[model samples]
Target chain A: MNSGRRQFIGRGGAMLAGLAIAPGMLLYDLAHGRPASGAVRWGMLIDTSRCESGCDDCVKACNKENGLSGGTGPADVQWIRKLELKDSRTGRGVSLPMMCQHCEEPPCVDVCPTAASFKRADGIVLVDRHLCIGCRYCMMACPYKARSFVHEPVHDQKPDVPRGKGTVESCTLCVQRVDRGETTACAEACAKAGHKAILFGNLNDPGSEISRRIKAVASTQIRADLGLNPGLHYEGL
Target chain B: MDLLQARRDTRIFYLLVGLGALVVAAGLVAAHYMEEYGHIVTGMNNQIVWGMPHVFAIFMIVAASGVLNVASIGSVFGKPPYKTRAPLSGLLSIALLAGGLSVLMLDLGRPERIIVAATHFNPTSVFAWNVFLYSGLFAFVGIYLWTMMEKRMNPWSRPAGLLVFVWRIILTTGTGMIFALLVARQAYGTAILPPMFIVMSFAWGLAVFYIVQAAMYGWNEMELNPAILKRLKNLLGLFILSVIYLVAVYHVTNFARHAAFERFILAEGGIYPMLFWGGYVFLGSVLPLFLIYFPRLGGKHHVLVASMLVISGSFCLLYVLIIGGQAFPLSIFPGYEARSSFGDGQIGSYAPSLPEILLGCGGLGVSFLITTIGVRALNFMPRDENTQAGD
Candidate 1:
């Protein structure tokens, strides 16, 4: 009877030990090593020539996918929107979608007091809604004017997309969608019309479409002199 | 109780309750009308996101920092005038904070959920620390007023006064940090703002006290001796000098650097140079100095005018900071640098809309209303054993 009791206790202890070790092993895999380099440095390239000025299909897709209230308005809470610019000298017009550039040295991240706004290992700049105070400092810090304050209370916020009142928000590069092995709303919508103005892929990978296009096209980062090194690039600007 | 005491007490209660009710009513009217119409009714837009609310809120907050001199006078330096008035000063600080926060709430989109500001704290944000510090200061001022000053001084008074003294300095620094920490903006992001804010606090606080005292003494049919007035004027003169020195240093350094930002600040096309020199530095600081320092002309009327201008100019300084910062947009398109947004694009400019102005005016009303009631009810004006208090 004593021998049987000892065997039962030892087995229970062994199971507990394995449970403790499992999380650490997972952490290590996520931190330093991943199979197939699942880690991706997400980037975007926009071809302004192909983008239609006022067609807001990407904006609509983002709003619907995020389940944002219609009252939020495109002007106030723009995750993506088409900007029309008129040249003073030539009177020429330029149209393109504007969103977070996801800068390599994002000013918004530098000024966030709680470190709630941070760049992911894959170079996606995101706001942790749980930690935002809506002080609007990040809005001021962002040179791209990419951040927006939540001015109205939202109802029926999509469970997949975090939302809160009295908080600052901006584009997350569609992190949730990326986790599901899907493209961003803007990219998906733009692709349907065979326009594909926005190309998203890992900049580090030489074989990726983004890398290839970047090499081939005359592209530039918006306000590169600011030294933000934004991952998003504009082709034929 | 005696008839005189009975009448005084009755008058105090009525005014206090009446003013409190009025503030609440005005708040409701503003929140309802403004929110319904959208912030468009106020002078604000995407171009100038903040406006009068920010100016008024900051003014009251900085004044709250200044009111601490009352405690400092009593304990830190043992200055007789402020030392004796310590308790009243503590209460006044709380009153200023209440007025300021009321303005902030009226400006918020979700005033009902302002608690979210506390629940969510972003460490990288100076505004985040401001939220925390403002709340902490409010609580500290409240407790200090109630337990230590409301009654008479107890053993806790000294320690409470010391704690408050230190906290007020931090509060002012945090207020300055709101602008100083922003590296992107050249107008405010210098090491100079923190000290400038502290000195400005002294000028503002003393000016407020002088005006209130003059008004209160007149109302009570009491004579305010010229000696006391002279001392107040002297302090005001000193603060004005310091403000002038700081302004000169800040602008000179910026101009000397000759960066694009420096040109933006000092140049004619930008609004900051106009506001800072024409309105704040020269008009606000220098004009007041002339009024107070020209010994021959430094009479009561001169001192009063100088103080009023300084007060007005201080407010203009806050406006210039907020508006000037936003005027320069970030997205300066390459290969086509046609002077950025304001200089070329005509993208956006802000003017405080009606609701914005009304809410801001209401904030001033709230401050005065509180000061009046507090003076009447709480004996805010200190009692000289040789004379009556608030009479």
Candidate 2:
């Protein structure tokens, strides 16, 4: 090929590449390097009676969105799991998903040696992957069994949901989606499944749907006596 | 002068050094594999996050704090008999701490990132405070050793020893609080854990000192002079009793409210109950007490055996506390029968893998190596009035 033709092709490719990346650059600006605000507290509420015992769309959706392996093994990581409670005498069973109950006074945050386990300004508890030394103190301190240490080498991780070996992890209330003014993957899946069991909203806003529902019903926070003041709520025994 | 080394069989010293090196190398290899493969290669899972490595690490750290009791008595309390053994006491403290801290750092999922612990200070974190507490122990004990060894610095030994004695008490409290302050598990969450650990350290640390002192004396074809043996054994007996009392209080206090949890440890939980009764309560506590306090069992030989039993019991006791405490499921569903595929409300089972055990043994190897080298190179041999003034 002639030098002029080759140069023209290369220039065209460069322009195409820049065109492809311009949207991402704008999105990065859209991300705007903004800080999580303390004024906005993200939360969830679950109506157990609407949740089906056999259905686990939330778990599947979480695995798919978070790039988890979806294995139920002793060593496998579970951002969320179905916990079934059975009354011994009555044989009445209640099923609900258990996960990180983002608390106002998170025990995990208090015990972390590196301050790797931290609460964002918006009251969403998170582990700073950079600082976490895999001490698992947060795992030990968590009251809800919300955390899981990555036992094996993680492969095919979703770019948005970063995970690795040795470090502890848990449900983030789908911070990535929440950051985009979207709801969690689990909540969306639960609603799509027609259960409408999970509710994700801003607890900081008195006008939010979750706030209205919690106020309307006799919803309760699991382990309220611990006084963690969890953002998550549940209704029905 | 060097009864165990210069004039006697240096062959044993080299042999032990070789053995210790081999164990350390094996541990490094095991640690490498764990790091390479992730903790999935080991028995640890989400449920039993802290396992055997923790048992060894905590034992070594606690024993390190307790080992200073010898120096405290000699210098701070101004006991001449203990003064002769002060240097040896300080040396063992450094050795045990180094070993314990090594295992702890290496066991992390991201061991390379351990420096982050120091850089990012979490004021509320007990573990973060321990990073300073543990490092300070090495520094203060090192200074204390210097004061005892350097004739010119003899005047400073008391102040330095007093500082170390205080530091050690705080250090053990930090270690105990690692579990004590943990409210998530049923087995922990009492303020008594700190005191319980301090008392346990007294027994465990003295137990370690006795074993090392015996070996050193035995290597020289000498016996621990019966008078010194009597005083030490009496102290060990008292410490052992204190450990029992504190442990009983911890369990008894749990009975009224946490009865099921207490029963799970005492009887219902299969391996836990067995280890508590057979390994810790009986073998570690009862037998050693019998050996130390029994009228006819006051011989030097009995003390040596008793020390071995005490050390064994230390391992069993720590395993029960660290691993067994973790094995009990969390109280997620407080008042109902809870079940999950994730082992919620289920007794978490963990069997230490070979690599994990080696990683733990490696800590012992490091301790052993340091002691062997320290004794051979320096005047760490206990120089009480009963023995010839080797110095």
lDDT value, candidate 2, whole model = 0.89
Please write out the lDDT profile of model 1 over residues B232-302, one tens digit for every residue: 67888898788778767876786664355556655654567787778787777888888877768777778
How many clashes in each structure? 15, 0
Query: After superposition, which runs of candidate 2 have C-alpha atoms over 4 Å from their true positions?
Result: A1-33, B1-8, B386-391
Every model: Cα RMSD to truth: 7.0, 5.6
Candidate 2 lDDT, tens digit per residue, B191-288?
99998989888888888898899889987677565677788899999998999899898889877767878888889988888888898889898998
How well is each residue in A44-141 modelled by candidate 2, as lDDT tens digits?
99999998886889999999999999999999999999988887678888999889999999999999999999999999999989899999999889
* lDDT string, candidate 1, A10-79, tens digits: 9998977876778546655568744323367788999988887666677778788887553333225666
Candidate 2 clashing pairs? none
Worst 10 residues of 2 chain B by lDDT: B382-391
